[model samples]
Target: PPGFVSLVGAGPGDAGLLTRRGAERLRTADVVLYDALVDPAVLALAPSAHRFHVGKRAGRPSVSQRAIERLLVRAARAGKRVVRLKCGDPFVFGRGGEEALALAAAGVPFEVVPGVSSAVAAPALAGIPVTHRGTSAAFAVVAGHAEASYGPVLDGLAPGTLSLVVLMGVGERAGIAARLRARGWAAETPAALVLGASGELVHTWRGRLADLPGLALPPDRTHLPGTLVVGAVAALSLRSPHSTEAQPAARADARPT
Candidate 1:
């Protein structure tokens, strides 16, 4: 008999956010290859499966994507049920498409189980809505890992008409802010940095677009992935102050009057 593979989304750091179908795949997995940031609770779901860590991080030694694809195919050919667990939606900058193509070329049987992407969930959990009536009717999610990924977004999208959600952008935020400023965005435009959403590490920093580069994550939060929110919607917070989630921190110079 042949084996199977499941490309499952682990959501954005919270086990509770895993979809029902995703959970089912894990429960029956024979071998699991997971990302660096997947929540431990989610991995615990595949208690009976053999676990392997193949996550990649900036400035760290990690497995190559091609190696991961090869591993998936090899494991399946060996008659094992393989699960490639990734953080956030498999197709959202997670290199899931590449893996799927590899599986197809190798003639491996596989399925993709989509989960919540941090691009929207992070900002939403931090009280910033990407879209709201009478505010922003449109939004764009951009990958900030490289200059090419975000350069065009800043050049093309007018700051007033759209909300911009940037993932993996914390490292290049200063450059992003400079580009926005040069693009004629108001110095006081609302901006925010949302980190560790849907988990205890969650925290939000809200401030003016000019002050975005100065909003630093604390030492405990430096390793966590972040989402950058810019435009009018970044100013709105639906989460109540009494809510269980961490409160948003406003920059000293950009605090509300």
Candidate 2:
């Protein structure tokens, strides 16, 4: 019999945040295909399943999206209930659709389970809300990776248009900021890098689009995932605990017309 599969969302980075359904699904999965961003404790939930790590990081040589799909097909063909566990909501830049399409083409049965996205959770962990009244309304979740290698994913961003929450953007930090500036974004626009998202280990670096690259960007940690916020809403950290009031101001999402 062709085994079934479930694309489970692992949430931002906190294992405790995993939904009851997500945890249950992991515990019962015959094989678990997880990403680098999944929390270790969540892996413990799948104690019995064979765990496979699919690399999808910034600069490091990670697994190709196509190869991951092939692996899922291979495992399912062997009659294994494979769990395609990914970080954050599978639909939001999780590449869940690509994997799902692969399964469908192979005549595999599958289900999708959603979870909290790092785009939102990371800012909250650092005391920065992506949305607030009298401040900002709309937001964008961008991919900083230019490609499978280290680059930038524009996602059609505009200057002072929307607050951008960039995932996996730490590696291409300089390039990302450069791109934003090239696209009419103000150099003084407030930008932030929130490392480890919701994990116990977290660091928030605040800066502007032009100065972001100089703010302790560690190239060795390319593969390590982090979230980047670019806009006035992201700068709310100054008012909150993420930073002191001395932080520089960035261009607000909605400025005086």
Give the winner by lDDT.
1
How many collisions per candidate? Answer: 0, 3
What TM-score would you give candidate 1 relative to the actual structure?
0.92
The deviation in Å at residue 152 for candidate 2 is 9.7
Q: Candidate 2: where are CA atoms >4 Å away? A: 57-63, 147-156, 218-223, 238-257
Candidate 2 lowest-lDDT run of ten: 247-256
Q: Which digits, one per residue and each the tens of the lDDT, describe model 1 over residues 1-257? A: 79899999999877878999999999999999999999999999999999999998778999999999999999999999999999999999999999999999999999999999998888877778899999999989888878787898789877667998999998999989998899889999999998777766777888999998777778899888989999999999885534443444321122333
RMSD of each: 4.7, 6.8
TM-score, predicted candidate 2 vs. hidden true structure: 0.82
Residue range 43-62, candidate 2, lDDT tens digits: 99999999989957545788
lDDT of each: 0.87, 0.77
Which residue pairs collide, candidate 1?
none
Worst 10 residues of 1 by lDDT: 248-257
> What C-alpha root-mean-square deviation, in Å, does candidate 2 show against the real structure?
6.8
